[model samples]
Target: MDCIANLASEKAVVIFSKSLCCMSHAITRLFQEQGVSPMVHELDQHPRGKEIEMALKRLGCTPAVPAVFIGGKFLGTANSVMTAHINGSLNKMLKDAGALWL
Candidate 1:
């Protein structure tokens, strides 16, 4: 639990995703397009799934695949991420996360 928190805390941006999800893929591509190398953790492959379980519990959310975090703060679902992009907030969020220069 502590280790997972530490890892999450260390990264400016972290995206927990399932490889099969289209929304997840889209977000990944968007980040790539912007040249942001977000720390990605695939929940399906996570050895410490319990740690992620606990983190999601802390956020009052059921462990749904593709949880995104910016500067260690939960930013909700992929649709929310896309909405952020559509609304022009995603770029600012990425910049704040140090994932982009502009």
Candidate 2:
């Protein structure tokens, strides 16, 4: 959890994800499509992934993987990202938060 927080703090955009998760892949694709290069942390591949999972649950995510963060803050899950994209606010949010220059 500390590592996760540290990485999030260091990066403009961060994604805590599992490599094999479709939602995670979708989130990654979404950012790429928008020209944002996020720092993706594949928790499932890490030794402390389960600990991170527990930490995410504490952070208020139900299904924690694919959690998004911007400006060192918890943003939301993939569903939130999708909703933000559909409503046309994700791009603006990313731009305003300095996650995307575009």
Candidate 3:
């Protein structure tokens, strides 16, 4: 929880993912294409995976891979992220999160 809090507070964007998840890959690609290098937390390798689980639970989100946070707010799962991107809301979100200068 502390790590995630720190990440959320310190970084403009953070993405939590597991290995080989298609959704994760897609979201990663999108961020990369937009030149946003989000801080990535690989839950599978994380010893504190339970903390992430608890955090998700507290946020009232289903335990899913590729959960994203911007400016300390839970943005939701990969599908939501993709939808935001397609709707042209992601860049604005990033900007609001202070993840991008422009």
Clash pairs, candidate 2, are: none
RMSD of 3: 1.8
Colliding residue pairs in candidate 1? none
TM-score of each: 0.79, 0.91, 0.83
In order of TM-score, best first, we have 2, 3, 1
Q: Per-residue lDDT of 18-58 in model 1, one digit per residue for the tens?
A: 67767667777777787888888776678876667567667
What tens digits encode model 2's per-residue C-alpha lDDT throughout 1-102?
787798787777889899899999989899988888898889988888888888998988889989999888888998888898999989888888798875
Off by over 4 Å in 3: 1-3
Q: Cα lDDT of all candidates, in order? A: 0.73, 0.87, 0.79
lDDT of prediction 2? 0.87
Residue pairs with clashing backbones, model 3: none
Error of 1 at 83 (Å): 1.3
> Per-prediction count of colliding residue pairs?
0, 0, 0
Off by over 4 Å in 2: none
For model 2, state the Cα shift of residue 23 in Å. Answer: 0.6
lDDT of 1: 0.73
Strongest candidate by TM-score: 2
